[model samples]
Target chain A: MRDVAIVSTAQMTNVRREQRRNEVEMLMPVVQEAVKRSGIPKGDIGFTCSGSCDYLAGQPFAFVSALDAIGAWPPISESHVEMDGAWALYEAWVKIQTGQADSALVYSFGKSSMGDVPDVLNLQLDPYYLSPLGIDSISLAALQARAFLEKTQYTERDLAKVAVRSRKSAKDNPNAQLAGDFDLEKLLAEPYLVSPLRVHDCAPISDGAVAVVLAADDTARNACERPAWITGIDHRIEPHQPGVRDLSESPSTALAGAKAGVASGGIEVAELYAPFTHQELILRDALGLDASTSINPSGGALAANAIMVAGLTRIAEVANRIQWGSIGRGLAHATSGPCLQQNLVCVLEAK
Target chain B: MASGDGGLLSASHIVEYPYRRSTGPVMGRFFAALRDRRFEGVKTARGRVLVPPTEYDPQTGEAADEMVPVGPGGVVTTWAWVSHPRAKHPLNHPFAWALIQLDGADTAMLHAVDTGVESAMQTGMRVTPRWRAQTVGSINDVACFEPEGTS
Candidate 1:
């Protein structure tokens, strides 16, 4: 595989809603910022890809409308996925590896505030069996949390601690929606929003966008002085039906981590896209992350999850840290589907 | 869609697939059984039965053959309490969404248990289907689950 590094990354998040801007308007500035930071001309970008959910937009081919932000007047090579931006980054990485594109642009956006967030997620369930049941995202995740608690040693308090730490970490992140020191006892005293899961355990429904620029080999060296080289990246999926798979253990995450070589080196920072507090523990165990690793230093998904963009934000977080001269090596994880059903892991190193 | 500032067009639209689709072989039998107030599962090559039967085995991807009667009664494998019911929820009262492992079935099926209170629900609780008086060969044919001994 060619040495591909994320040359530049930019994002805007942690806001409850972006009422004024459409997806294109929200993404345009981030795109311009990322491309400018890379010092790469917009036209020099060999490929462009975006990730967003049409369900959230409530329109067919909704992503096509987002193309206006990138200015496709000259007709640039582009593709899209009905998934998170991390998956879009994966596609761009594969394109570069295939020698089809040397440098690429990836961006994703989500506006969960437009509609009933939990109810909207029900549309992604199994139409025949699950959807008819009207099992929304929070309820399904609550079920997972309950099952996780029953099987593991963790408790609601442990989950609360994860929430507390996440928000505390977000205090410095101006882009974080939920931040500041939370009282543990007060948090525990809060009533459950859905049985085992309290409001704090769940991610804030957020609206935002993220853009990343990737350059391979010499293009990478020229674009940034300290590049966060992509050492390993892989994603894996499990059976789609939640009942058929074990919800407590993320075998898919473990598989993706193994393929991404997460355990091969010492990780200085880790950004995990765990929307729920309990899920962070599951992903941590799956990826073999220990206490030594700085987990979710940017507050993670729990602090400012923006649906489709949160996963890509995980990658951008680690890459940004590497570029800032704080982290030598890192691992980033992104998950999709219910109960950590599909997972992607990427390992980054400073060079 | 709300009207936006300037000339940019905005309109509210409800995106939905207002259409009917065939359930196909295995699921056809499963729903047909539901119409008769019965429960059935597809027996896979491994002899394990999967409720909400798929035409192909989930584990093997081989064609599923035997349609075996599984359960009108099952035990909750795991559950989460729904304190405030949504309009779309099966029951208006508080209930538990459970993964039920019916007798003779290897895999679990998701459904709502109308427990009325959170304390009434628990893992391994016995529950049975409460069928709709008028069945239409749909998942809602079983209105929801209720405590096994309750009327």
Candidate 2:
């Protein structure tokens, strides 16, 4: 595959609710920033791809308005994914690999706070079986958390620890909506919002936008001093039915990680987009990351869980670390559907 | 074009769905606050406050527990004139949608503006919320933003 690296990443401050602005208003700045930072004019971007959910905005063709954010009067070649922006980036990377485009831009946005986020997420479940049950996102996650606790040695306290650590790490992130030091014991003391999962164990309803710019080797070298080279990128999907798959193990993520060559040189940092705490642990085991590697230095989805944009933010966070020369090798993972039914893994490096 | 059996079976399916959402406790509180003619934001662990409060903080990824009153007025950070409005937009007439940073809040809130004069709506224009007479538990509770000096 041809060498492609993320040259610029920009995102709106993740918030609980973006009431004053629509998705287009929220995305314009991030898109402008990404292109401006890359030193590439908007017209120069050979391809554009975006990730978003029609359900979140309560409208079909939600992505069409977002095009206004890009000022597509001239009509640039563009496509969109019903998945996360990481998958969009992967598609852009493929476009570069095929020698179709030397540079590409990927973006994602969501207003999860527009309605009941958990209830809205329930729409992602199987329409025939699970949707009829009306099992919302948090309730389903609680089921997974309970199963993980029953199957593994991890405890509720362990889950709280993840919340505490993630919140503390979020202190440095200006765009993070949640962060701070919290007593794990105190968090545990709070009544359970969903039995096995406390309120802290669940991600908050959030609204935000993000954009990333990708360039082939020649463009990458000219744009940034230390481009985060995307060495391998791959994604996989599992059967949508939750009953058929092993919820405890994300076989799809593991498979994608292997396809992306995540274990090739040992990942120094990993950005796993697990909105729930237990999902983080499941992803950790699936990606084969140990305590030695730094996880979620940007506080992760638990910090700023903006649905469609959260997974894309993971790729940007890991790439930022490489761009800043903080890590040598990193793995960025993004997921969609219920119970991690779909996953994308991207291996980034600095050379 | 002809089919093997000398007959063509051509069909097209057009599906339209309207979603009904139940505003849960947090969002319910937010809309309730709006109905009361007050702007509220959820306070995050980092101490930065966001308007139309997020149920969770974007930084810590934790649920926002504290509700803080933000603003009825603030400065317009950035705006774009909506010369052509979409079907579902709050306003059917031509207007400018702006990102207004409400007073006492760290971030901006998006809403439509009724300044009438598109040329006057700049990044730093001061504006105030124009609330709807009939308040529903939705973002449309605030009809739009109007230039502070106009009314």
Highest TM-score among the candidates is held by which one? 1
DockQ of each: 0.77, 0.01
lDDT of all predictions, in order shown?
0.91, 0.81
* Candidate 2 stretches greater than 4 Å from native: B1-151
Runs of candidate 1 exceeding 4 Å displacement: B1-12
TM-score of chain B of each: 0.90, 0.82
State residue B27's C-alpha deviation in candidate 2, in Å: 37
* Docking quality (DockQ) of candidate 2: 0.01
What fraction of the reference interface contacts is present in each model, in order? Answer: 0.76, 0.00
Tens digits of per-residue lDDT for model 2, A14-50: 8888868998899999999999999988899999999
Q: Worst ten-residue run, lDDT, model 2 chain B?
A: B9-18
Residue B50 in model 2: lDDT: 70
TM-score, candidate 2, is 0.70
In Å, residue A120's CA in model 1 sits off its true spot by 0.8
